[model samples]
Target: MRELPEIRFLTSGDVTGAEKSTAETAVRSALAGAQGTVTAIRVTLSVVADPALPRPALAQAIVDVDGRRLRAQAAAPALPEAIELLRDRLSVRAAYLRAS
Candidate 1:
């Protein structure tokens, strides 16, 4: 089967940042590695200040596959950690989506 189509995400909304490429690459990597057919996918991310933490903000990812959306929100001590959490979360979501 063909690899699944995926739209990755990142801190930046547009496709011009590490996070964007990171998100997209992860999905594409996951789907491609599994040899699954891709229908459609979209991932969006936003980094905003955290009102409660007195920090820059948090990283939130909203992913859409076909007609379903998977949201992963995490507040880590750092952006890298947040991305890691998001990756794990998205991975689980992708697995779930692929199964059913």
Candidate 2:
């Protein structure tokens, strides 16, 4: 069996443990179908605060596959949504890579 990719999460601002776990789970599910195509994935989550209200969370995902880098970013009201969006983008890229 092929080895799954290593996932690293770098978080900033206010991030709860549950949020982190959700992001990791989303990434894992996203990559489940492309196990052999990806070697490592790094996700960065940034929470920005505004004087009036809190801004949406920003998530950036970088996937390393065969020495090539695939990146995607998303901003959402919730952390999990942002991470899931990034994962979805990566999944699309992974599919293309597999086909090529």
Candidate 3:
């Protein structure tokens, strides 16, 4: 079986330790099944917060697989949720890449 691609993350903004961990885990899980297909994975996360809204967090993710790049943006009430949204979006793109 081919080895899974190395995943590198570039993060910025108000990301906390726990949130970073969660995002890493989510990215790993999201790409776990892509084993022999993916050559490399890079995910960039940018988190934005609004003082007026204490609950929701806005985040954007730019995912690179092999030489292709895709972008996804999401807003959720928590960091994990926002990360999950990004992972979900990337997973779809990954699947499409594999199919083609």
Candidate 4:
């Protein structure tokens, strides 16, 4: 499969380089299996200000597949976990979009 053109990562200082790589890998892996003209891919990682929340870390992805937009989001106490969740969710959604 041809490599994705560019993956834009939107994050704050709280997000580390390792976490960005992890998120990028996860998104690429998920999108690799998708069947379409992937025009753009954007992943956002953020930490909620409220520490009281159970899952402060957030991962979100927006993929432009054949001009259609598909989105997936996940939250966890840790960035890695959130990225994992995002990958799985995005994979499923992508597959469904392809099927339909």
How high is the CA lDDT of each candidate model? 0.55, 0.76, 0.66, 0.91
Which scores higher on TM-score, 2 or 3? Answer: 2
Q: Count the backbone clashes (under 3 Å) in each candidate.
A: 8, 0, 0, 0
lDDT by residue for model 2 (7-71), tens: 78899988888888777777666666663567778988888775454546888878887787778
State in Å the error of residue 37, model 3.
Answer: 5.7
Weakest ten-residue segment in model 2 by summed lDDT: 47-56
- Which of candidates 1 and 2 reaches a greater TM-score? 2
Residue ranges of candidate 2 with Cα displaced over 4 Å: 35-37, 51-55
Residue 58, candidate 3: C-alpha displacement in angstroms: 3.4
Q: Assess candidate 2 and give its TM-score to the true structure.
A: 0.81
User: Compared with the true structure, what per-residue lDDT tens digits does model 4 show for residues 13-89?
Assistant: 38989999999989999998898889999999998777799999999999999989999999999889999999999
Q: lDDT, candidate 4, residue 13?
A: 38
Ranking by TM-score: 4, 2, 3, 1
Off by over 4 Å in 3: 1-6, 35-40, 53-56
Which lDDT value does model 4 have at 94?
A: 93
- How do the predictions measure up, each by TM-score? 0.55, 0.81, 0.66, 0.94
- As a whole number from 0 to 100, the lDDT of residue 49 in candidate 3 is 66
Error of 1 at 35 (Å): 9.2
- Name the TM-score of candidate 3: 0.66
**Shift of residue 68 alpha carbon in model 2, Å:** 1.3
